[model samples]
Target: MSTVTLQEKKSYRIMGISLPLFGLITVGVLTATYMEVLPKGMIGAFALMMVLGLILNEVGNHLPIVKDYLGGGSIVIIFGSAALVTYNVLPESAVEIMSNFMRGEGFLDFYIAALITGSILGMNRELLIKASVRYLPAILGGVAVALGLVGLVGAIIGYGAKEAILYIGVPIMGGGMGAGAVPLAQIFGSSLGVDSGEMLSVMVPAVALGNAVAIVVAGLLDRLGKTKPNLTGNGELMELENKKAEAKEEVEEKEEKTAINFPMMGRGLLLAVSFFTLGSIIGKFLPQVHSYAWMIISVAVVKALNILPREYETGAFQWFQFVMTNLTGVLLIGIGVAFTNLQQVIDAFTIQYVLLVAVTIIGCVIGSGIIGKFVGFYPIESSITAGLCMANMGGTGDVAVLSASDRMKLMPFAQISSRIGGAFMLILASTLLRFFI
Candidate 1:
């Protein structure tokens, strides 16, 4: 190893000391604020949560074994924040404010809007078309296997085959909160003559737990790819043969379009929000479909039809990069504090509970990986996008799992799993529940 420079060593020492000092000071401030000695409000709550998320993320990113196997700080920011709230380290008021910012203030929606708009628009038209068609079967395979395996595991664990598939499997395999569990609860509740609230109470935990497990498994898969490089595409979701003759001119043409300027970024932002709004308006009219789904369709049509100019696509990609790099920590913190419930997860601590969820995730990976190979995708890439993405917590989970696997460029595929795959879940649930009930 190269010897460290004195300046670098000094910087490291400073960081080592400053981080702990900052922690003690932050604790003092939080305690005073909790007691009403320091002023408390949204500002403090957001700032503190951001700080915690970033710090936790940094620590998780660098922790030796964790960075390799558990997706580092992405998982940490979430479960760690939940732990703070559960242990009363985070005061209820602060947690509530953070929750409101995420849900009531719509931060999660904001992040998803930007990500979906940018990713879909930025894709190569031909590649997008080729990928989307092949991707669906991979997603279906994941869903089928995940539900089947969870049911089998549940039976062995005495969780019952029907209950396992109906409650644990569907919920865990469902998209995520608003799009996944909420609608599923309504469908199942109506069929079973039980209240929606009761169904949600049963479903939410499975979704949360499944999301957590998916993220961790993604990290493990990343490590596996590193140790055995042949199994992965290394960010290319499709198969490639570097030694063969290829379409060099097409790549050059795509590269030429990637010019950047401030005005272009602004245009990109406007286009993104406008597309998101169009989806929202459509969603208002079509209550059955999620806005993101509509947005994906609208953008995909525009891309496939070559309606948008090349410059605008580049702009969207640049804008997405900026937002993902800067605001990801903030969004993750919000998910942990607002969306995760420590008590609920804790209450779900049973062998059957954990085993069933594990089986669901494994089923997703296996089903998607196998199907993806036949459809001309790399097995690992297919599993991540088609399987784990379906098993995750919708949009936010998409970001977390993709980040963990170091494949943020696969956002479009990830969104498909969340939006379209989630839609498929609703349809399947509606049909299956009738038989089960």
Candidate 2:
């Protein structure tokens, strides 16, 4: 008999048989409903099903349900499946009814937005250590200028052609490009007596689509960076040394711990949640300011005040990043399916969307690449760094991209430089775009 390891079990859970059960059930129910073969209350049924699915996931985490099926992918499948069913099965009348109910419940965009902002803010710590004040300021200033100019363009065009303002600007700015993307869309939908949820449905998918694409692009760039050697610089070395020292101290502290009295996970979650909530409330009051940008700024301000610990519990940042991004993704897909006309989506598939996407991506790559070269970064290093900037405009995606890519070459300076670029642009450009637009 063969011995089974935990890793093998995880792999089996991810692929072997259980995955199909969830996928089939979700897709089958959705497709049947869309075909009008299912009962009228299919949407409601699915909604309840989603709750059950989430509960199952949480339970599975503590117990062993379908082996490894209770992990992240399980919840996503449950939520996404219900959304697909509702979108497909329901007519416009039904969709409007459901969307109205959801809208009335009040979306948690503020909290979600703030969490995203906090993650971005947290990513900038590496920048303060690497770049000189002089050049860093200049780079940030450029980003601010870019954001303002883009925002102005969005505003000018938004008055006449709102769709263009959204689909075009959001992806270019950093996926959730404009400060006003969600709010303006909501406001406009409300004033026109349209269901704001429908618009949000559209916006969420667009954001998710952009994020998925950005991840792939970042991954490709990371792979390219690995082929080169000069990926880091002198600044990186110093930063690494400091990190090692800190790690050593942390190890010693852990060894000294004989009692387990600390509420480690609970405290970390509370602090993160509190900061996120406070930041979001502040964001709602600031019209035309990008929520994420404001959130990042708020976190930075709080950090500067020295209120929270330098680091919270283990994997807190990772959890925050994953939850925020995944939630954003699922929400977008649900919105897309619910509000968009599936037939129209098929018809609307044009070369234009693809062309726009391509040009935007190319612009990001070339622009970042040029800047990196000027800073004396090697070709591979510059390419990856530029790729990070182009894809994220400085968010969690940027951090992930750089961290993964930098490890291949250990190009610490290049890594920091790219991070700084991303941070500066995400905060400055995305936020400022609202004013001009």
Off by over 4 Å in 2: 1-11, 14-107, 110-114, 117-166, 172-262, 280-292, 311-348, 388-437
Off by over 4 Å in 1: 1-45, 91-93, 151-260, 376-437
How many clashes show up in model 1? 0
| TM-score for each of the candidates | 0.67, 0.54
Clashes (N, CA, C under 3 Å) per candidate: 0, 13
Q: What is the C-alpha local distance difference test score of candidate 1?
A: 0.74
Best by TM-score: 1
Model 1: per-residue Cα lDDT at residue 265: 80
